[model samples]
Target: MGSIEQPEPTVKIPIIDVSGYLAGDPKATAACAAELREACENQGFLQVIGHSVSEATQKKFLDAISRFFALPTEEKEKLSQSNSPCYRGYEKIGGQKLDELDTNATTDQKEGFSIRPERPLGKFLAGPNQWPEESVVPGFKEAYMEYFWAVHSLSKAMFQLMALSLGLDRTYFDAFAADPDGICLCRAHHYPPTPPDAAGRTRGVGAHTDFGALTLLLQDTVGGLEVLHKRTGTWHSVLPVEGAYVCNIGDLMQRWTNNRYRSTMHRVISPLSHTDRYSCAFFNDGALDMMIEALPGCVPEGEKPAYEPLKVEKHIVERYVQSYGAGGTYIEQRA
Candidate 1:
């Protein structure tokens, strides 16, 4: 007799609500903090609800970016990132290889536009952004800039919760996140549908760890995000949840927690069907020059930290060099 087939195991990424905590309820804050600790230790990825970014704002942001990407190829290439000293502009598909280890294999198959709100020249990556001419796309800059601040506000609150999760005071990360010049980097990525033949051979983005403190991602319904399960050792799809932002820790956070929290490896694969995928990632890296090391609260009673201490800028720039090569070089001379 043939054996009965086993049922597929259910896989779910944890989702947390912060509305109550955001409202200043001490009990809710503690509960959210504990949940954050568990999620960080195990999955390293979660969806956040009650983040206070309204649906209208989210729609406007997406619409503005979608309009920009829909422009003619020549028009978009006018702002090619390769020409930017600050590395802030359009990047054509296959411009980056996120999985630096697989040199012989395919590079990432997505196009992107990166922006950092204009600010004083302070650090390597800090300066004005490369935006499309106002005449080309009316109100584009304003819409994107508005969304940047909205998402950034949410990131700050999440940092406080992350601090509390590690059994530290809520203000633990405030100093690192206090600088406006080093505030954040936002990227809008567009992944064209995967060709039928390239389905198994190419990835929209290669597997890699984020080289920052925190990342908040807003994705369209054409989900292609996947996370590697720590225990199962298999990749699972992170489906889109309406009105939610996918949140995850980054390398600096992992170092700060002495490996107590994870900086999980993740990647994106394009839809094999005709659907395109769009996502905007808001990365809050903390003050660029801030030193990153294991917090005393995170180190075990006698064990040494797993990673060596380093400055936030050093770690981030090294990762960029790996992915963008010479194109990632920081431009010192301002135009």
Candidate 2:
């Protein structure tokens, strides 16, 4: 039988107020910070409301996602997975990584477009991003380019919350994430309808933890996001809370905190209904060249850093290729 989503206190994910953060109010920001700490530690995930991005920006991004997905298969294939250097461009279902797959796994059922922006000063952190010429999807490039900056702005505020929640100066993560050459991708995804009652078969994006610092997901009205509760080890559907972006810790965050935090597993089950599923995820990451070491505040007395510091960019690439089947294929690989 198909399961209906229920509100479970078995896990308490926060729904933070970003009003103060947006208004530049210090005290309100502090309150939100404390709420964030509880959410991160207790649930490792949360819903964010009051983020400064206006409804129009949200709509434009959505329009871009919907437009890209609406294109005919023949057109999308022009910028096939094989054509891109750093694994950017249009990828059909089963093109990149599937769940539970190693370096090479059978392609899964899903299609997506990945965009990782170039730094302003003529430097590339991610493998080169391969974009289709504007002719392919009129204004796709223009809309996406603008969207990246706005998402970056939201992510920076998120990082500050993370820093404060961990008992550090607000700028603690600034140096690490600034101009990161990391795989900070804007992944626009679509999962077509699936068997309506295929009880517990599989999902559009099978169970997996993202390979970055934070993931800011903007989901359409037709929602299918679910998370694995760390405490009970049970699954729960995050009901589609309109105008609220879901934020969750990624694998790297858990490693950096030595498990004080968690990178919970999540997935998108293809909807049983016959509607196309559209969602945009801003996967915030740093430069692969930057090392991710344990934060001093997270390390307990006599407890050493759980994982050795590794370059954010390289570590993520290895995992991406290992997870999705696209590594070092997008852009020119940097040292």
Candidate 3:
């Protein structure tokens, strides 16, 4: 009899400790930045520890999301993302197709809710979030909003590290980070258990690069995320790291670094276990109008920029439209 095949072990994404950097220690900050440079250049994914977001805070936010996803279909549909012009609300399973490059790709098998800062109306994907009534889930809104700001603060610190990693002043990316027009999106995703007959036709999320500058992800221990190793053309599982956020650069970052830093492809498979999986992803895409071009130190001495400069929002909107179709259209037909 032939032996049974075993699943590949989870790959070890580089881990970095940044507590000292957060405390304004120049030496620790420099060391942290150096490690960041290596991870960005090679794997484009890393685990961040010592970020100081308490486990209680993380649990509160995730618990809120789990409660929201546990609602009945009819109740959830009332806050459907389709009703919002900016696409900020509950997204039903299969609402997005991330692997658009694949001719045979099917819709993703996940449900989610997206939230952005409650900015004034009149901007693309900017406006009030769709929240469930406090009666239904007391403190749900508060929990998520608190986490949003916490992660936002961490993202600014990350941008500073990224700038330093490129051999530029740590403040080189500050303007972009502080721009009010920057898009900071947070999402709660729930991947239900895979059907027995799914047969690999669906994914929790498909293989694709993120559309923004950086992504900070918090995932549960069920573990289905995988990253594509560009060098070897193989996929490896990304196991959960306790008390750490899994961070990765996105396409815009790749553009800014002239591809010196990679934007690796990643995807999630539906968990085969009876248990469900959940994740929270925060995307820190810089200012809408910021130009994406090679940074001063990112380009080689004689090589021209590999990518033409493009506005951050334009690139993001195009990618959203491609994935979300009419659901991704801007409110009031305004770009």
Clashes of each: 0, 22, 0
In model 2, the runs with Cα more than 4 Å from the true position are 1-12, 101-107, 119-129, 132-136, 180-182, 195-202, 326-335
- Computed on alpha carbons, the lDDT of every model, listed in order, comes to 0.82, 0.73, 0.84
Which is superior by TM-score, 1 or 3? 3
What is the alpha-carbon lDDT of model 3 when measured against the actual structure? 0.84
RMSD of 1: 4.7
| Per-candidate TM-score against the hidden true structure | 0.92, 0.87, 0.94
Of candidate 3, the 10-residue stretch with the lowest lDDT total is 1-10
> By the lDDT metric, which is better: model 1 or model 2?
1
Could you say which candidate leads in TM-score? 3
Model 1 lDDT tens row, 40-106? 9998999999987889889998888888998998999999876766678899887887863345546
Clashing pairs in 3: none
Error of 2 at 171 (Å): 0.9
List, residue by residue over 130-180, the lDDT tens digit for candidate 2. 665677667777777787778888888888888888888988877655565
Error of 3 at 255 (Å): 0.6
> Higher-lDDT candidate among 1 and 3?
3
Q: After superposition, how far is residue 32 of candidate 1 from its true place, in Å?
A: 0.7
